[model samples]
Each structure stands twice: as structure tokens, then as C-alpha cells.
Target chain A: MNVHEPERRLVTLSDVARAAGVGESTVSRVLRNQGSFSKRTQDRVAEAVARLGYVPNRLAGMLAGSGSTAGAKLVGIIIPSLTNIVFPDLLRGANAALDHDGFQSVIGVSDYDPEREEALIGALLSWRPAGLIVTGLEHTAGAVARLRASGIRIVEMIDTDGDGLDIVVGFSNRGVGCDSARHLLARGYRRIGYVGHDITRDLRAAKRLAGFRETLREAGHPLAETEIAPGPSSAAAGRAALGRLLARRPDLHAVYFSNDDMALGGYFHCLAEGVAVPGRLALFGFNALDIAAAMPQPLTTIRTPRLEIGAVAVERLAADGPAETVDLGYELIAGATA
Target chain B: MNVHEPERRLVTLSDVARAAGVGESTVSRVLRNQGSFSKRTQDRVAEAVARLGYVPNRLAGMLAGSGSTAGAKLVGIIIPSLTNIVFPDLLRGANAALDHDGFQSVIGVSDYDPEREEALIGALLSWRPAGLIVTGLEHTAGAVARLRASGIRIVEMIDTDGDGLDIVVGFSNRGVGCDSARHLLARGYRRIGYVGHDITRDLRAAKRLAGFRETLREAGHPLAETEIAPGPSSAAAGRAALGRLLARRPDLHAVYFSNDDMALGGYFHCLAEGVAVPGRLALFGFNALDIAAAMPQPLTTIRTPRLEIGAVAVERLAADGPAETVDLGYELIAGATA
Candidate 1:
């Protein structure tokens, strides 16, 4: 990447006006996308600007807008993983609300690293966004301090197990896990096992596992086996993890997965090995992704309020209402898989 | 969502400095992430700023920097969809490269709508980003014009069939389709079918289909059946489309999918129906996503350089390289399924 070269004469509005044969105000009106201009004029101005490589100084124009110091109408959203459909779905919902409000989201991906999250927080805070939305409550100490130090409205989304920095919206991960365990146990599945990806990175999954195990222990029917892949969860990893688990404990009646991605992997494994689903090895997962229901035998899982959490989070952020934690709950789906 | 209220009193640096019991220069140094300052002093300033709700005017600080007119170190990345792993993969790769360069990506999702792309272009350009990266060359005319007029470095990624508005980094979609057709034909499967989502929305898929047909015509073999889902492509849609195709023309020895997503759907359909993959029905797809390899019978598909396109596009943009198109071609994976 090349660094900025030595100073050169900057292109001004007058340069664009001279090039387009229009006044400075006409160039400003056309470039800002505010005032109306003739199609021919817009085209001519656009062509001239392109040819001259003229950049409009938005900072100057923004400050010049109607005698107000409103910082950019921007919001910052930081997510853990883009690979997971959950985050994308949340983003989709958030964008719907944000777009309607005429606010643009500036996004950052943490890739589930706390240090990266902190760095992104510092960078985003530097922009002084109107509001910031982040995935989970868990953050590095620096991130927490920086967020608290930044006066922008903050929304901690997707998890509610911990105290939020500001407005919190989402279901409890532990509750979803506890409900999943009870649902499976009520269906007469003892000798349960677990198949998932790394727990250290995915704190929400860890909470789920904790709740699942707690429920099992209370029922005097503890987990029989567990296969934890030391990486991010994928269908293949889930399938491989289940293979390892079943190879060791073939008598395992059922298995819980980190999420639908892992469960789908297990489901594929069952199909490949000719292990009759539910009758042979019942499968359960969280985040009832679309593929889960469309499976040959629909997957029995927990449907977390992913889209709603995002939409409502944006709504609250835009509202600038009194800060509060909102627990949008999850639902259990009884499908043919379990 | 509440509308912005009338203009109010603005918080100044002097206010922050006074509240922190420090000089304005000390506060500015800590806020700018520049000059040496003790942790205690930084904390004191950050606390005061948050308490006083002071927004540092980035525009003024930016202008205060050495006489370079570089806008905020931000790049705008606009994608087609977040639902498809393709875009997420692209984003992940782009973020990795951009983060390494100390640049941040502000993303917008178009969801394959040209109008949305145009609107997002206008909105993103309003930020006066240092550069902009968009998914494909086929954009609304206004979008193309605005992007050209914005005078920021532009990188058009993932497709290279059309004249780019700026630096283009991707292979030909038509070439990929033609190659996919040839791969299946060489494997001795002639009675081929096609399944996809809406062709009108995704111009790239339409280009692929056009190339596939051109190749098939050149081979003296045309598609036996075609199933194009009205909505976005998904595994379920793939299954339904294949089911429809088989119900009409059971003689289809092989099927070409729009991408791996639809192919995975077909793969799942074959699994559920007890049809032996590659024996009873052959499957081929584009974009060799990770799940395709994890399948019991790995899917035969074209591995597009999605990650490379994203990473290299950012590299080229950061380098401010001369305007030219870069073709980071595709690879054909001869997996077990085909």
C-alpha cells in the first residue's frame, strides 16, 4: 500500500464548476444529492467530475449544512462472525430499520477475538457515532472502558446473560440451553451426548452447554459423551465431531450441538451412516436456521429471536429512549429429528 | 424511531479539558491517539468527554493533521447479499487485508437490488470514503455515474465481464459457466439440467447460465430441463427445483447449479431419496464453498477466487494502482460426486 505522497494543490469546487461550465453552487447541489438538478446537467457535471478526478469535501459541506453540528448520521455495528447465518440475519433486520431511518451502518467484524473487538471499539468510538450496536456483552476490559468512556448510545445485542453496557436486546443463551435439554429429556432420551465446535471462542455456546448440563444433572441423566472441535463450527466439523463421539459411545441416545451448523453436520453423518434419525440418534440444535426445517426430517431446535433482536435494537437506538435490557425470548420447535 | 431534535449547544474541547482538569493539548493528544500521554491522563480525559457528552469534531482534527486532504481512513464495501456465504467470505477476506493496512471497511448490503445499490452508493459516497469496493460491474447507471464522479479509488470485485468504472478484480462469470458445462460433458453426462434462483435479480447468475448454454450448444447438447426458483437460492429451493426437474425429465444424468448453495440442496435431495450420488444423478456447481467439500460425496464444482478477489482488490485499492482489470481465475474441483 502506498503512503500519501507530498502535498499537491487540492481540487476546489471552483475547479469542478469551471470544468463543468457551471457555478460552484450547481456543482455542490449536484454532488451532495440534495437539491434537484436537470438530468442533462447532472450528467454533464458527473462526467466533468469523473474526468477531472475532483473529490467533494463532505466534511466542509456537512458542517455547512443548515447551521447544525450534527455528526454524521452514522451508526456502528460490530459482529462476532460473518460465517454464521445468525449475524447476517441480524444485519438484514437491522438494515431494514436503519435504512428507513436514513441512517447508515458502519460495520466491524471482531472474528470472536476480544482484542480485535477492543480495537474496533476504539476505532468506531473515534468516529463518535450516534449509536453503536455490538453482538454480545462479553468484551475485553479495555473495550468496556472505552465504550463507557464514549457517550454514544450503545446497544449490546444477541445475548443477555451479562449486564449490558446500555440497551440490551435478545434471549438468554442459558435459558435456551436449559429448555433444549428438558425438551429432549421429556422425549425419553437419556444417555445424551454433545457435539460442537470450540467453546472458548463462542461464549454464548458455552453458556448453552452450561445450562444443558445443569438441566441434565438435575434429572440424574448426565451427558454421556462430548466431542469438541478446536475450531469454528461448520457442518463438516459437526459431522466429524459426531463421528468421533458415536465411535466411542455408540449407545448415546441423542446429541445436542452448538448450533444448527453443527447439528446439520451431525444430521448429514446420520444420513451417510444409515443411522435412522430420532429412532437411532435424535438430534437437537439451537438457532433454528432455515435449512434445519427443510431437512428430510425437520430438525428439532430452539429458534432464537435473531432478526427481531436486530430490528428492535436499531429501533431502540434510534429512539434514544431510556436505556433498558429487553429479553426477546426463544422458541422450541418440535420437528421430526427429535 | 425519533427524529433528530432541534440544534442544541455543542460540547467543545475546552469543556472536556476543564472537566478533566487538564490542558486542551493534553486532552487533544489523548483523544487523537497521538503524542505521549500517561494512562491516567487518558482515562481522565475519556471520562470527562463521556460525562460531558463531547463529540470530537473529526473533520477539524482531520484538517488539523499535516496538510493532506485525506478523508477519514475508511473504505466503503457494498455487497449483494449476506445470506450467501460468498459475500461473507468476501467480507472476511477484505476485512483481514484492510485491517492489516490500518483501514476500516464501512459495509452496505444491496440484497441484489440495483436501486438499493444506487441509494447505498449515494449514502456511502456522502461519507467521502478514501475508496469504495462494490460486488459487480452491472450496477444502476446512476450508481456507475455517481461512483465515477465520487473521485475515490474504486474496486469492482467478483465479476469482470463488463467495462469497469474503475479497477476491476475478478474472473469472467460467463467463462466459469462455460467451464462448468464442459467439465460435466467431458465426464460423459449429456442429458443435463439446470437449477437456480431468480435470474433477473442476479445478473452474474444470468451471465453464467448464458455461458453454460453457449457451451452446451457448441457441444450439440442443450439443457434437458431448467428450474429457476423465483426467490433467492437456498438448499431447500435447490431440492425443490431438482425435484421438479426430475419429475419432468428423469433422464437428466447431470445437473448444473447456479452455485454451491443450490447444489447442496440437490445433494441433500439425493441423500434423502436414496439416490446414489454420481451413479444415479451427477451434480456440479459454481463457487466451491466449504460445505461442498464436507459432503459425504464432495461436490464437483468451480472454485472461484472469492477470498483472493476481496483481498487483492483491497491491496490494489490501497496501492492506488493504475486502472486495470485483474483476472484471478477459477479452478475446477473434480470431486467424488461428479
Candidate 2:
């Protein structure tokens, strides 16, 4: 109903053939390199395709069993948050690798909702992508079933906590949490608290909190006070969460945040309130985002292999192998804050 | 050729009709609300569709003579970068709006390459999305021709200097640049410098630089110095650009950066090198990003209406009418930097 007019048809193989002054069969053979074609014909067809900007419909060709199609090269990548630098960084790596490998990415944002993720997965699957790279292992049962039945390569990213449908590419979120707790404990911070968005909804953060509490229990410190804000983690949310935590327990030695956004917010709060950094309260966070190091006082945090994970995910998809996990571990940046 | 095995077919209208205990014609009539159908038939058919997850292929239906289907609900959103926080934030807003209206976004990243952008445009149009939302007004002639021929809702986003194919939704990059220059001049910074990435590739940045120079020339204070970095703007790149600018003209009173990323890097450079911000050298940038306000000193920069542009683009697509240009406008946040 919204159509203004009929679209001009796409430049097809026949058009390329006509433009190149060659038979359609010759053009197909040249494009596919299936049956032998002369060098002159190949050059002519290539030139014609360039002039026409003829991008073959790979999806349609894949379905039609055309010789010229290299099957499905489109990789469907679904992530949680685009505003969160982590997801974009992840896409950067995937895109770089995919571009080099002649693969295109069809991106879908789930907005941290598994039901949305499931719907997106179904839509992406309908397009018949070569691979589906989704954020985290957690998914609705329907999503899991669709993924398992799709036959396409599956790559679950960011959090490596559950069994993947096919391949998994990321470090252990739980380990990152436990390690943060240990780092704080080593710094002689007993009254360490937690500042993050709602963990139950964000399962990865939930895993981190569980690991953090587990380690704190071992150290007999326990979680001094916790502020779990109910929504997306942001610098503002982080600042507010920190404010709430401090109001309840002003003497908490330090706080472990869900991610760098919250940590940055907390850092801003300290700057705003003139709180002595480590002298009064130490701060630690996950995802050593670009801003972390550039800050006046660098944020002490864990840098996950976000880009590497994305790159490896695409690389694995290109390799076309059996199900396996590539544990690109996280790094600990011990800045002055902690 | 790379198929692991055969796949199941998409849910057909025939299947829905059979499941609903009606003929295919009745089902189509009920679904499209064309020929009259009993209320009972409509309910049964709708229930069957819901139970079957029958997403009618919009492109196919459009070709097959259906005024319904909205033709397509998938909006193809093309941007220059995924890592640039600005683009992501724009996408966040677009996605929210699109999702609210029961539409999905198919995102394509061109990484600031016009040729890539052209290719991506072709690929996106092949899918027959309801609308095409692209980053800038700049495009290769071939790309412009393709977009004009595509016959979908074409929205040129971010920059609004050139004539759009259909609807234009963004602020003027030149205006942003001129405003920043005027803002800096009012602060009495005569020996003004610029730290930026290669503007030739980022046409929007080029317009800003041109406008900045134009304003400076009118004021009889030609740009004192400039250091254009080679690639994408980053804090690291910003620091280096500032370093280069300072090495040549140490007495430069102020430096305007391409965007906030470079500005933040310059800010960090001053923080690390013990140079007093605004006292030793005033700093200014475009795109008042999130970290800008939350920083130790809020960044003095322009905040383009990124999210609003995205939201409005989709809204325009949904509304479907005559071509229009929306000047969402920009804001100059007079922070302590200048």
C-alpha cells in the first residue's frame, strides 16, 4: 500500500551476459567457475558486472540452487544493546573478519529480551543465513529449538556459562566476577559492595554477582551492601546505584560494578563528591571499555576479549567445523582505583 | 552448495487455510480484509496464523497483488560505523521506534566507505524492505540512481546538506561546524587549531571543517593550525592529533576536534600532560556524547539530534506521504572546556 511505484528490476546474470556480449551459460560458468570458461569471457563478464554493480542475490540463488551463488554468506548477528560499547565492539570484530572472508552480517538487536531474541532468530532463520551469532547462551525454549533445528552454524557469544547449540565464543562471566572479588580482597577491601542493573534479567551479570558473592563468602567478607537497579546498566544508573549503596553503608570499602558504564558513573560520583579514590572507596568493573583507561584516574577492571570473540566467531563460521568452544579469556587491568 | 541438508518449507497460506477449515481464497480474503468474510472465519483464520507463526512474506505478497502486508515491515538501516557511539545511539532510538511500530531493522555498516555503502544499499534493497534509512546525503551517482529506482521510503539521515532521494532527516553539518567556530571565537581563542580524522572520507566532518574555516575567515582569524589523523576518530587518535598540532604550534590557544572521541582524547592528553584545560588551551568538539557530560569537566561540544533523527525516520516511513526534510537541529553545550 505504501509503494510509490514499481521498482526497477535488479541487474541479473542475463543482463551481465548481454552487457558482456556473451551467452548466459558462459556468464554463469565465468561467475561460478563451474564449467571451464575462456579468460576473455571471464574478463568481459567481470567488467560488465562491475559496470552494472550487479550484486547477485545470494539468498535467492542459494534457494534456487544456482551455480553462481556461493551458498549463504550472510551471517545473522544478534546482540543485546547497541548503546553499550561492548556489543558494537563485538560487531566491529565480526564485521572485519566477515568482510575479509566475503561474508555479510544481517544484524538484529534483541534489546536484552529473550522473547525478542527468539522472534529475531526466527526471522533471521527464515532468511536462511549461513550462521547465527547470538549474544549469550540463555534463550527462550522456542529459540533454542529453532536454533537446534535450523542446521545453520550457531555461535553464542559474550557469556560462556551454558551449553551452546553449536559453538561458543567467549570467556566465563562467572570467572570474571570471582576474579574481581579476589582482586578486591587482595587489596585488603573487606567491605566490598555491588552496583549493577537487575541481575535476574541480565543473566550474565547474574552469573558475575553469584561468583562475586561466592568468592566473598570464601573470604568471610560477604557482600557488605548491594544495590541492584532494575533496568539497563548505564553510567547514570551506576551513579544512582552507587549513591543508594553508599547511603545505606557509607563505610563500604569498595564496590564491584556490572560493567564499565556503571564504574565510570561511580568514578564521576567520586569526582563530584570529592571522595578519596582508594583511600575512601575503591572501584572495579567489567569490560575495560575505551573510556576506562582515558579517564583522569584509570578504572581498574576486566577487559573481555570482545573483538577477538567476534572475529573468532566469524572465523569459526567460515571454517565450517564441528561444535566447539573457543575460550578467549578476559584480562585484568589493575588501575589505581582498586 | 554449502547446505548441510534440505530444510522445511515456510508456513504457506494453504496451510493456514487448511488449519482454519476454510478455502485458500477465504483465508486470503480474511487476512487481507479484501472480499467480505464472516467474523467467525476471520477469527478462525487469525487464530490459525497466530498458532502457526505464519509470517506472510511481504515481498512475495506485494508481487502477488496484495494491497495488504504493508508491503514490508523490515526497515533497512545503513550507517557508517558500529563502533562510533553516535551511530549506535541513533540506532538505539530507531530500533525502539521501529520495534514499537511492529517493524524490524536490518542494519548494514559501511565503515565510511561510499563504495561499500553503495554495495550495501543494493544488497538491502534486494531484500525489499519497507524503507531504506541511510547515514548521509552523500552517495555515488550509481548509488543515488539505485536508491531513486528502488521505489521504497528513502530517508537520508545524520547530514542534511545535499538534496535527498526522498525524505531528509538530520541537522546541517556545516551549521554545526560554523556554530562551534563562533562559540570558540566568543571565548577569545584567536590561535585556534583543529584535531580531526581525515575529513575527506567523513563528508559530514568535511562540511563542519569547511563551515568552521568559513566562519574563522570571516572573523579574520584563519585556522591557526590543523592535524588531520589518517583514519577513524578515537581517543588515542585524538591524543596523537593534539600532540602533532601542539608540536608545530605550541602557543595555539584552542583546538576544535572532529567529534567527542577526539575531544575526549585531547582532554585526556591535557590531564596526563598537566596542561590546564581552557586556561592553557581551550578544547571543543562535535557530538556531545554520553561521556561528555559525565566527565570531570563536561565537554564543550555540539550534541546532534541523533536518536530523534532515527525515530523520526521510521516514523516518516510508517506515516508514508509526501517527501519532507526534518531539521532536528543541534545543541551547543557550553562546558568548562571552552
Candidate 3:
């Protein structure tokens, strides 16, 4: 088997110019319709471009005009993972907002690695995007430095716990944790446990845990047990972690999961094990995903304004405004689970 | 509030050269670490670049060098939607492979609109990506024309039902539907229903349904009912659609969902409504998602090689092999639900 070479050579602007019997500058002017050109010249250029199949390089066009930094209609978005539905929801909102404003997104997944985030930031900045949207407030020093030096609008999303470099659009993760603890406590579940995934990489999850613990401690009922599953957060991991946590502390009356995915897993475990939800053991979660509500016993969770956050981030990037935090806030759902 | 202007002007290569007391070409050579340059000149250029906060214009560099096509380390990926976990899984695999080879991805979402797909194709091609990966074989005539004329490697993913412009890497959607129908038939289900999302936009689902219907007809037991939700597939939509379908055709023995998300919703519906799954009614779905297995009674579904398709597409794009179709087959997971 031989490697497939490019089927045909790319038709250059020069080719269009030659075919149209006009200078390259005239061809460019006619195509861009920026400078004064006759109707006949424009027609000739268009016909030549169509016939030659010349796709104008926007990158070069932007550079030749006002530089990519000023004219490139691109946004760079870096997220932790796509496996979790939360990130996709965020992208959906961002993409819709961007599409409306005629901008395209160049995306990078950091995989919860600081080094990777730094590398991705450098790679993305090379495109000279109009703005950069990164997940959370936490980033490597190198990554932060690049964002600051890029001289473009920077929007840090999904967390507002720390100071942002420029624009910050998200609710506080710690606040979600606190609200969850308060909800569980209000329901009179004292012996509460925690089930989560890797918090080191998912810093927001860590913040949530810290807030939950603090809220629980303040309520004079500290966490009874904690089971943190290794690796990324998933339904299987949540299910397995819940089983282990229950095995360790059978007396635990409630469990606060890191998010809906893990909480759904816990819910599944309860159904399989015949543990009566909100009777034998209560459950609370974060991010009220669509599935969370559709379950037999709807999950008692915090519904972060995921889509709104994404949309607002884009709006802020486009709007001429001072850099400020836009906390869309979160809603605590009193579902049957708790 | 005043709009946030660019905090500072971008430091150009001219600034670096001026600071380094050298020509712009000398500064470029030193920074790229290409061509001959004196050690002292390199040191001076590096110092000036650091002092001036100069970020290199990779777009300009690529255009000036071998043009963006041969030199740009970018791959344009246009997926249908981010809301569906299936697309993200595909992207996750594709991104991992691309990252390993030092390639970045510029992504656009078509939202299952043919016109939008055509527009995105035009936009992506303007970047002059080394290769382009678009979802599915079905595209508008304009989109197909653009892909054929682009001259770069093109990868059509997720469905192998039609002819491709260049490389095709996916399993047959019709086969998946056929196999699923057979699975239900072998399980002794006669009066089977299909709960799905909009088949018009989701052509893959349409293919699956057509294949299922054809297979069932050949076996002398045609489908009993079909409930198609109006919007994109989601757990909520699935659950709602299942309710509507069962309400209309309570005599149905088994139900096939378009994908796991919809099936999961159907599962939830059963749990909520006390419908005895696989006892009074059996359930089958496609895409063996993580949550599918963790459910109380695991969902009997087909596990499409989503990740492998994405990874293989990238590998083929990078590989020096003749353009060909790769059939990465799927698996049928016979879980407790069916």
C-alpha cells in the first residue's frame, strides 16, 4: 500500500490573477471587495476563482490586512475532559454564541494536566484568536503567562473561586459544595459520606469537597467517610466507589457525590443493592444533568448554569466592557433522592 | 462600562530585531532554530524576544514557508454535535492521536444542518488544514464538491453506507441495525417498537431503522411501532418518547432505541412506570456507554468502535497508504435488559 498523496495542487491566488488577466493585487481587491474595482473586474475575478477552485487563505488574508491578532475571527477553548457531559454542555453554549457572531473555535483538551494546558495554550495562541476561554481559574504559571502576554481577551470559565486574569464567567464550585451540604443537612441526614474522583486534577471538585466538609463541620456533623476513586469521574467509578464507601461505613445515612455522573452511579448502586433512597440512605449531587431529573428518583443536585455560562462568556468576550466576574450562580434542586 | 481594549500592543518581530540589533530574518532564523546563525546573534535574538514579549506569527511563517498546507500542524475536525457523548468520544480518540503527532485540531459543529456543514467546510478549508475529518458520508452537494476540490486528505467517519471522497473509516450503520433486529428476533421478540430521535437529520439513525425494518420484514415480523422525538436525542427525549410509544402500543414486546442516550431514557421510564423490562417488554440500544453497564439491569446494546474509528481515521490521514475504506466492526452486548 502506498501513502495517498494530495490529489491535486492547491490553486493559488496568483493562478486566479493569471486566469483573470489581472494583477494579483487587483484579484485580491476584487475578491475581498475592499478596494475600488470595476464590475467587470469583479466578475472576471469571481469566474477565475470558481474555475481554478481557489480557496482564499483567511490566515494570509488576515495577516496581510491588519494582522491576525486584530482580524482573525477565532476563539481558543481549553477544557479538562469531554467524557464528562458538563464540558460538552459548556461547549454547546459557547459554540452557539460564537456561531451567531461569526467566529470559529479551535479547541484543546488538557486532560487535567497542567503541562498539557501550558502546551495547548502556546499552540492555540499561535493562531492569534480573538479571545481565549479556559476551564477554571487554575492554570500553570506558564499558561497564565502566555494568556496575559497574548494581549487578547481571556475568559476563564466553570469556576470563580480565585482571581481571574481578565474576564471570569462561572459560579463558585465551593458554593455548590456548601449548598449541597446544607441541603443534605436540612433533610436531617447526619452520618453523611463523600464519594468522588481525582480531586488533584479536577480542582473544582476539590473545592466542592472542601466546602462540603466545612459546611458539614459547621453544622456539628462532620463527614463520616470519604471514598475517592482513582482516575477520571465516571458512572462506573462512582458506582464502585459508593459500594466501597458503604462497605466501610454501613451506618452512613447520606452521601454527597462530586457531580451528577458519580451520583447517578450511586443511585444505580442503591437500586441494585435494594438500598432505599432517602430512606435508608440519602443522596446529593452536583450538576443537575438531564438524566439526573429523568431517573426514577430524581437526583437532589446543584444545577450550575452551564449553557448560560458558556453563552455569557462569549458575550463578554465580544462586548466592550471592563473585565469582571459574571457569576450566573447555581440552583439547588430538592429532588426525591434527598 | 467601557469595552476592554487589548491591554497592550503585540510585540512584533521587528521590535525583537531592533532590540537585538539584527535583521528581522536573523531574528526569525534564531527563533526557529533553522538556517545558519552565529551563537552571539542567537543569544542576542533570544534576549530581545524575551524582553519584548514577542510571540511568533506561525500563520505568517507557514504561509511564507511551504504554505499552510504542507507546514501547518493543524487538522480540521467538523463534528455533528457536542451534546451527544458519541461525538465527544470520537473527538477524544481523534485528539489523542493528533496530539501524539504534534497536530492541533480546529473544530466546528454543524448541528446536523447540511447548509451549516457546507459553510463549516468552506471555513475549515480556508485555514488550509493538512487534512479534514467530517462526520458521516451524507453531505450537501456543495459540501461534497468542496471536499472533492480541496485536494487534501479527507476522512469521512461513523457511517460506511455511501461512497467517500477520499478515506472512509467506519462500520456500516445498516449492519448495526440489521444485527440489532436479529438479536431481538432471536430473543423471541415479535412485536417490536423503535423509539428514536429525528431520523431526518440523524441519517445514521434512519439507516439503522431502515436496516432493522428490512431485516424484521424478511423474518416475517415487521416492526410494531416507532416513536420519533422531534429534537436531538437525549435521555429526557428518550424517556418521553418511550412513554409516548408504550402509551400508543402497549402490546409491543421489545423496543429498540436509536442510541444509548435514548435507551437510557427508556430504561428510566421503565423504572419510573414500573414496566418490567425483558419480562413484559424487552429493551435494546446502540452504543454501550459507561452508564449503560452500571444501570440496575445493564442495557443490552451494540458497542460501536467510536474511539477506534476516530483513532484509525487520524492514523490513516497520517499514514502514507492508498485511499481505502476501513471497516472497524461493532459488538453486540447482550446485557440483562434484553
Best by lDDT: 3
- Residue lDDT tens for model 3, B112-196: 9999999999999998887899999999998988987876789999999988878999999999999999999999999999999
- For candidate 2, the lDDT comes to 0.85
The DockQ-based CAPRI class assigned to model 1 is acceptable
Candidate 3: lDDT of A148? 81
Per-residue lDDT tens digits for candidate 1, residues B178-252, read 999998889899999999999999989999999999999899998878989879988889988888888998888
Q: How far is candidate 3 from the true structure (C-alpha RMSD, Å)?
A: 2.9
The TM-scores, chain A only, for the candidates as listed are: 0.84, 0.93, 0.91
Compute each candidate's TM-score over C-alphas.
Answer: 0.87, 0.88, 0.93
Which candidate, 1 or 3, would have the higher lDDT against the true structure? 3
Q: Which ten-residue region of model 1 chain A has the weakest summed lDDT?
A: A1-10
Segments in model 1 whose C-alpha atoms lie over 4 Å from true places: A1-72, B1-59, B63-72
Residue-by-residue lDDT tens digits, candidate 1, A122-169: 677656567899988899887887776565679999888989888999
Clashes in predicted model 3: 6
Candidate 2 chain B TM? 0.89
**List-wise, what DockQ does each model earn?**
0.35, 0.35, 0.58
Model 3 Cα lDDT, one tens digit per residue, A1-338? 21234444678899999999999999988876777999999999999988887898977876775443347678889998998989988999998999888788889899999999988898888877878999999888878888887877899998999999889999999998888898888889999999999999999999999999999999999999999999998898999999999999999999999889999999999999999998999999889988889887889988899999889998899874788999999999999999
